[model samples]
Target chain A: MPRENPLAPVERELRVAPRHRLDLVNEVDADVLALQAELERRGYGPAEARRAAVARLVPGGRVIRQLEDRHRPLLGRRVLASGWMDRAVAVGAGAAAAFAGVVAVVATASPGGAGMTAAIRWLLVFVAALMAANLGRAAARLWVQGDLRQEERQLLWARQTGLIVAAVAAGALGAAWEGYPVPGTSVGAGGPAFVPQSAVWEAIGSVAGVAVVGLAVAVFGLFGWLLVTPRLITDEECERRIDDFFAQSRPRLTPDSTKAQSHAQ
Target chain B: MQVTLSKRINELLVLAVLDQGPAHGYQIALAVEEQTGGSFSFQHGTLYPILHRLEADGRLRAEWHGTGRRRKTYEITGAGRAELAAGAAELEVQFRALLGLLRGCHAA
Candidate 1:
């Protein structure tokens, strides 16, 4: 036979709610049990105090409804609400802008290159266009989604977005100036260029090689950063964020207080 | 008769009460009601969610203090105290501003 739960009726009622959390039910069990004991200690009969405790705590199924609103799986809401998501988006855009920097460098450095360079220049150029498209894409999201928890954080998000845009603009101009096409000169002729014309494929290979190295460095840096920094926000922060969801998640004026105030008046 | 408090005020009050000393759910709620001179009260049902949420946030630390129907007692953490201090200051400012506005209205 199972041990008797003194707050069985209260527990049973809370449990009856659809998809109710057991942890909450148990806590309520302890609360009501304690309240009943306190009432008994204050001179109420055992049975009367038990009945009163249940009535006081679980009034009209309100708590169960409030719990449903406040404590349901909050990962989706947190992903939207936590300021870090916007930060991550800003960081991503910044990295793409940095890659755009490489694009400007390659474009101005493309003329009169060594052999085998043009062979891979096209691929790097493709990636450069892709970054430009991504910068625009990221910028669009920033305009529509500035919903952070605090005004200060929202301002930070704006600043980060601004920095990303600045980087992109500067990177494009610099790379274009540096990698300008040679004037009136074919691959075999002297022209307005930097490195002397030779193996186009080899220059392309060199750019790709540099890109590979940069990508490897970024991956390792991100991994190391993750290893060192502890995640600041936990599920608890979500509970705080959704304050309005559980509109009645609050304490109340007890019957005793009202009587005390009324008697004094 | 029960008067439900706003969550922010309730949280602030809870933290303030716990700052005095450690207590379990029932004792904390009772203390708040008694100390407020019947101005505030907490239902067992309504308070558990807040307590659990606070515990999760590291604002309050809980430990089962006794055996055989032993209750889970809560102590205010450093974070809880910091929040309480901030909240108290904000509330005081708001009340002062409110009082000033009301007095000006009466004068008018």
Candidate 2:
């Protein structure tokens, strides 16, 4: 007699079972299809709709929660009441930047102002330090939330590290520009004429400085925009987004299929 | 106008849909949307959890059926029907009260 197939019994049981829980694979596929259809109905092209559908299904993490929370205080609140604090902060930052710019210009215009130059240098360092501290605090909060997976945590750490490194590089370039030595040219003369090597370092340092300033300006603009923009999502919308994320991210398995597969193995 | 459904109202909506007969998730969603004149769109995340919760509470029964790919369908229980009736009554009372207030405002 031929050896009996061990998989036969499990397959039989699966066939006999009247009801089974919906497995994750089918669940995700159905949800994605539904989302895609909905998005397409809203005038998104097929590709764009699919991409959006996938993004909606991504698993929830600390980063996502943080982003969602950033919008929460504005939701369902009176516009004036919800935004006053952020508007105040943005106005204060703009004033500080304007004051710093004026001070730097005045210090540069002063005659034989070695001291003023030193103060300018200190100001740059102070700004860099402030940026670093703020970035670190934000990163720390994200970490403390502890909802991130290992990969997400690593990605966040890598991004923060890159920003810190860039800030340090910018600060160093600024300092180098301030102290760049003059190169001596031997013109037939009473003394060697020293030309300040500020041109090259100044260009490089200015680029870095502009980049940092632009980032700060962009952040301030974002804050202002957030303060002004009406709330985009209701509580139901938020809950829906969160649910889609989890539904997409979590693993799905059916018991009977697993048993059947295992028996076949 | 878009009507925002509270959690209880959403639950009642699901129960009312199932009261017609057994229906799969997608079908139920379609039914609700159609009944509301496309004003109500239920996301999978919102709908599935509610269905599972109802099943867990013995207010609904879920069974999988299909040949190639299984689909989970739900049927309303007696408890679910009772809850639906109570919710509809409550909603009717509140809606009438609001309507009366609006009429009073118009009179004033």
Candidate 3:
């Protein structure tokens, strides 16, 4: 007869949902036990074999999180849940908000006329892109499942995008300097095309403008890159974190197993 | 050495091994660890996500060996073979680029 999984207690503690329990998994139980048996045959003491087997597991919290992508709740239900879903829903609900922000831009601007409007429009795109990217990062965290390396790459992408936008903002400021009407009264004509003061984005003030698939799309694209390029972690600190953070939840070693190990030794 | 692998490499490596024949997770983990001389070790549990993801992505298929232990044996699908081929080609290109870059630095 099959034995109870060694990890049932840990599973209970984690309250791994019924849907994911199958995956929690019987395979792991079998593997750990089989490895333990093999180790004992090879003259490893019971405790030593048990330790060796336990060390092979991923970790507890991570097992549930990693499988989240596979066992994600149904769409309508998922959006109702908080956290990353809120980020996704906020982006989804943004069409109405985008319309309102457009109205705000229309109502708020002084008679700085078409020049200010044009400058504001470009600036709007820049600021909205940044906000959406920052907010959407929460969602990407779900996709990465706490892989610091992926998080590192995501942060790098965000910084690069910020720089590119800044470069374009500089050019726009230059145009405004040439009497092209930069976004704000702060940027008086011929004053500096690039205002050294106040974020060039200050122009999007009162504009709740944000919502785009760019950062998340880029994150997904990065996964494609990640699949082909492997970065091996050899650093002790980094490896330990990855090991601790990415492992499957496993059953605690039983006192009985320890005793067997001691007796064998 | 207990090196940590990015999911990218893990998927490709698992698919490459599965392509040889269907095997359980333990078998796959052992095979890779042994073959790599301990350089590409997995914490055993880490391999499951990649296995399940590939299965979800339709690149691999899994079946239970028996109900008692429920040992899952995974095999690469046609899509998996195609992915393995493409990924292997890309890795080769990267390896060559890395080698050339290092060589240039040495020559300098």
Candidate 4:
């Protein structure tokens, strides 16, 4: 014979109320009964197991705050690790994409010259801009999520602002200098002469480009390095350190003779 | 006797319970309470978050089962089992130190 549903009446009643705490309580009670049975099977005495099951019968709201507080530190560590891993992966993928772009530029430049150079320059600018935007977003997210004090947050913001201002000034200066005429280049009677620019300006542009790329590389490399370095202090070690710190601060009783000597002094 | 649940110990307990076989959230909580002889009480809200975190860490696999009232069932992975063993060892060391501290306090 098919077993009758014990909760049929409760379900019907729930249909009328729809969103009631009483329905939640009933569901929790059922779960507690199931837990009690499992506890008995594991060799806990019936009364003791029932007590444990009953403890969970309280409304979830009352206990959630305590649970979150207890687990916050552990959760924080996990979040930090996850964020670092994400940054490392993003950096790795970005580097690979940049390398592919360079290869494509080389292949395309072989067929055409002036037009290709201009296209490549624009492509480079686009890639650099995209990379900067991505880094900015990542840094902002990290700062927002971080459990930093007010002063630390202000310091970080200032440093980031300085970095942005410096980068913009350098880029603007480089762009302006890039359009300067070559030292020997002059206009011919028929048309303009195509003389290669001064080695000095070319060298400066090369240095500027290298500096920008190097900065990006350095930032990504730091994150990648952190990802690979084995953790010096595991959770267990941290716990032990905390315990030891407390133990050291705990008051100790001196010997009676020592106490007397101190009192006499 | 009521005992505060250590996050590390609670994780091991969850993994250990699932090691027996695949089980749902309520069942895991039951097994943990029973095994600890009611000393450790874990609420549904507390257990679910830990389960979700363990799943994210790839220590456990979760799948929704049942109809109408869908239930989430969990199973331990190899990584979880390895972690349980490591946690047990670490707990042993912690307990030993704690016992010594308690004994010294009593003597003093």
Candidate 5:
């Protein structure tokens, strides 16, 4: 059977292992130790320092969960600190970049003598934007989960795939733009004929259009991941905190399983 | 009751320290003690583990560089910054409510 997470303590007041003693940890981890010291500095008691030490050690989500499990009854501050807003920001950025790519493509594709190749250049720009947005989101998720997610891992790989495709398409576009030389007019024994110069904007538009597609892929892929994944990773750190804080207090109630599981990214 | 109050206060204090900039486990300890007039001092040994834990949780991140010889530095992440702000705001609300509660009887 699956074991209980070590971080999943039965009691909210549970502490860390003796070897991971608060006093011992305080001496080594300056940031939190400073926090513990400040408690003692402010004349707060040892127990208070210890509890705060644990809170500082764990992610805010875990700490908040622990507080709630204890029936602390107050949660506004903790919720805000979990950084949910930042996650939303990442999603929004991705969507906007994808939308821009689409617009570029349409402008390039227009038939009134609009140059497809020029539009393609604009598409490249959109592709770059798409890449940046996805990368940003991935980085945020990595930090949020304190690890990588399967979908995000896939997205990362797809990024490499995307690069290859872009390179090939760019090469083709370059060849077409330079080789054709904009329908150059030439004198022939047959008769005079009009040759239209390649429209720079048309190429720009085509590139932009292609970029839109790339952005769409990024947006949809991220969206699918968001939809499919339980989204447990974002809360993983907090969950660990919850498990640990409670587990330490009620040792017999639940065995610490986090030690056995390398669940976090 | 005191434990609850103290935990909130401690979080506030440490975050306030970080607001100044990032510091290592040792530096944070020193800063906390110094800021609190030595009334507070961590065991020094215990601080590192806690900092590691924080880093694990995304509240802080580590930056290792070759400084003179060897030393690792730590800084708060954006999430940590947000947490600090949230914590401060909560404390402010609590303090205000507490002040009002304390003053109500006298006013009446």
Candidate 6:
């Protein structure tokens, strides 16, 4: 009674190889979500969005490849490794700063040009340490996170760190060369105790100190922003999103039409 | 012993599963489970999407027919068969190489 079956079933089930299959359905789903978001932003309706999304994936174009590469396992792994490296550098720099500060404070308190030289040397070392740490953090975010937003935040932080440290280092070095106790009120002296400080060296050190302080203030203000943007998407969130993606992608990835129908139910 | 297959290797498994016979969706899913001794399971929701894409890409062909009730059946295309062959050969080479490495490690 029914029309001759259009499709005849083969006697044997097709065989699949163990290799060359990846549980990347979730990753593909993420791409679809991203694509959908883009389409919505562009004012496309849901139906149009889906059609376009399929078109984007098929015909062997590199479009899907580019999207897939973004969510690659290797990319996530690299991001995690970078985070570890950044944290390590940050800790090391903090330690170096503490060491340098202690040395500078102790050495600077004593009298003579030698004390000033030591202070300057210690300041230079401290600043260099801070710069290195900031650079490490920036590098980690840029290369590992693969998030442009995070990279920008790190870049800003690094720039401020560099500026502040450079000022501190230059101020200390100049003061040492000038052979003067930094021009501030001496404990017993009256009338702001000029202390016969050279106008040129004093002016250089003052400018450098002011610049460093300014940089520190800028970095402090921006610190909150750095924490807010580009958060490390947690492992749980990653897993959940990946799961959702696979679920949505099942219809397209599966070949047996009947299976897709059953699953859709 | 049950071997662990990762998500990355699941696509190959799908092809392998289909190779057993011309099965509708659920049947192939069952076959995969049976052959792998319940070690490997296909997610119904995810599997269909892959199947549709494979059909669209000409790796598989789908036909709608009525057998008392309406149902869709899919079969691998020539292209799909070729792909399976290539995939199998590549996997065999990899497995042998991995086995050699594992044996060497055990010897050490």
Prediction-by-prediction clash tally: 25, 0, 8, 0, 62, 46
Stretches of candidate 2 above 4 Å error? A1-25, A31-265, B1-5, B66-68
Candidate 3 per-residue C-alpha lDDT over A74-145 given as tens digits, one digit per residue, 9 for 90 to 100: 452345353556676566457435743653454335232244445554454454444445434433433323
| Better DockQ candidate (1, 6) | 1
Worst 10 residues of 3 chain A by lDDT: A206-215
Scoring only the A-chain of each prediction against the true A-chain gives TM-scores of 0.27, 0.26, 0.35, 0.27, 0.35, 0.31
Number of the top-ranking candidate, with lDDT as the measure:
3
Please give the lDDT score at residue A196 for candidate 1: 49
Name the best candidate (by DockQ).
3
Q: Name the top TM-score candidate.
A: 3
| Each prediction's RMSD to truth | 14.8, 16.7, 18.4, 20.9, 14.7, 16.5
Q: Write the per-residue lDDT of candidate 2 for residues B1-108, one digit (tens) a residue.
A: 343457678888899999999876655766787799977656523565567668867899987555444445689999999989988998999889989999999999
Pairs with steric clashes in candidate 4: none
Model with the higher lDDT, candidate 1 or 5: 1
B26: Cα error in model 3, Å: 0.9
lDDT of 2 at B67: 47
Tens digits of per-residue lDDT for model 6, B16-93: 766654555545554566688988765423445556556666878766554322345668778877877887787789
Give TM per candidate. 0.43, 0.34, 0.47, 0.35, 0.32, 0.32
First chain of candidate 5, TM-score: 0.35
Better of 4 and 6 by TM-score: 4
Native-referenced Cα lDDT, model 6: 0.47
DockQ, 0 to 1 scale, candidate 3: 0.21
Candidate 1 chain A lDDT trough over 10 residues, lowest sum = A227-236
The segments of candidate 4 whose C-alpha lies over 4 angstroms from its true place after superposition are: A1-59, A62-265, B1-5
In terms of DockQ, which candidate is stronger, 5 or 6? 5
Residue-level lDDT tens digits of model 2 in A1-265? 4432222222122211011111433443444455556556668887786655544432223322322332223321233345564664465466555645754554344332354334544454344444444433333222222122234434544544454455444445544544443232223334757444665555445444534443543353344334322222232243344344434433222123332222222
What is the fraction of true interface contacts found in candidate 4?
0.23
lDDT of 1 by residue, B1-85 (tens): 2324377788888898999988767677778888999898876467766776788789999886333223467899999999899
How big an interface RMSD has model 5?
Answer: 11.8
